[model samples]
Target: MTTPPFDPPSEADIATVSAQLGRPARNVLGIAARCVCGAPTVVATAPRLDDGTPFPTLYYLSHPAATAAMSDLEATQVMPVLQDLLATDETVRDAYRLAHETYLADREGIAVVPEIEGISAGGMPVRVKCLHALAAHSLAAGPGVNPIGDLALAQGDWSPLVCQCVDYNKDRASAGQ
Candidate 1:
């Protein structure tokens, strides 16, 4: 299939697509909760104490309601808005910061649990998982001037697999587990 032309996305466009898809204006707290606790499985594991341990990871759909709400036409219409968000410097920076913060929080929270194994550092694992999630979301959502690609590229080999895991987990969650 031929790739469509890339254009900047706008908030108005996002709203339009969201409306057509019946996207609800859920609160951030709700969104965060869905992200953390709604998934079928939530676990933190490590092979050894010194080894880097994966923290309490929960995966959920980035846009749960909208995923089902959006038709192909609506998604196509919203593509420009998504692209614009990806292309803007501020948006890119903000997204990275959010992902980074999420990672740090996950790491810190997992570190105190004591049940998890293989944890040498909490920060890096969190960052890795966050990046993986972001990349997976981007790829599934479709590519158009993605800013998160930088972080995914930095990790290279692992990013794709992590993204795949993110996708898998999200799918599993949406399936009602």
Candidate 2:
């Protein structure tokens, strides 16, 4: 496989991401996708952290709005519906398998961890576990790659085509984070 190009994150990007996540961003390799407002929506992380933790979630959702949207979808019990779609529809299942393959390729392109070799986040190729992880992959890899992710994104309130990020710095200033 050819080595994919990567854009390394800057110090400022790290700081902003830390603020966005309300904690330190660990082993972030690059910004996977950005919002219309220029803030990061998804981040590509290293397969292994500094402490040797094997984190399989390569594309991490960073935007608060997107996270909230996923949370809302999860609250509405959308995973079972999506899981049923995968179970009943061959085309959707095939596409989801492909998405899983693509996700594995992207993660392996960064670094391969033995424990997480066959595992992709968001219960790929089988179940709908985390909409956030799937949606992050959809945002990073674009539409048609992950059908479930795309569907979830379509069903959700937020859209990457439009900016929905809050003014984090301003909010922090007022709340004293």
lDDT of each: 0.34, 0.90
Q: Over the stretch 4-77, how does candidate 2's per-residue lDDT look in tens digits?
A: 44457889889879988999999998998998877888989888999999999999999888898999999999
Q: What is the lDDT of residue 4 in candidate 2?
A: 42
TM-score of each: 0.26, 0.93
Off by over 4 Å in 1: 1-57, 62-67, 70-81, 111-177
In order, what is each prediction's RMSD in angstroms? 16.8, 1.8
Q: Output the TM-score of candidate 2.
A: 0.93
Off by over 4 Å in 2: 1-6, 167-177
**Which candidate achieves the best lDDT against the true structure?**
2
How does candidate 1 fare on TM-score?
Answer: 0.26
- Prediction 2 global C-alpha lDDT: 0.90
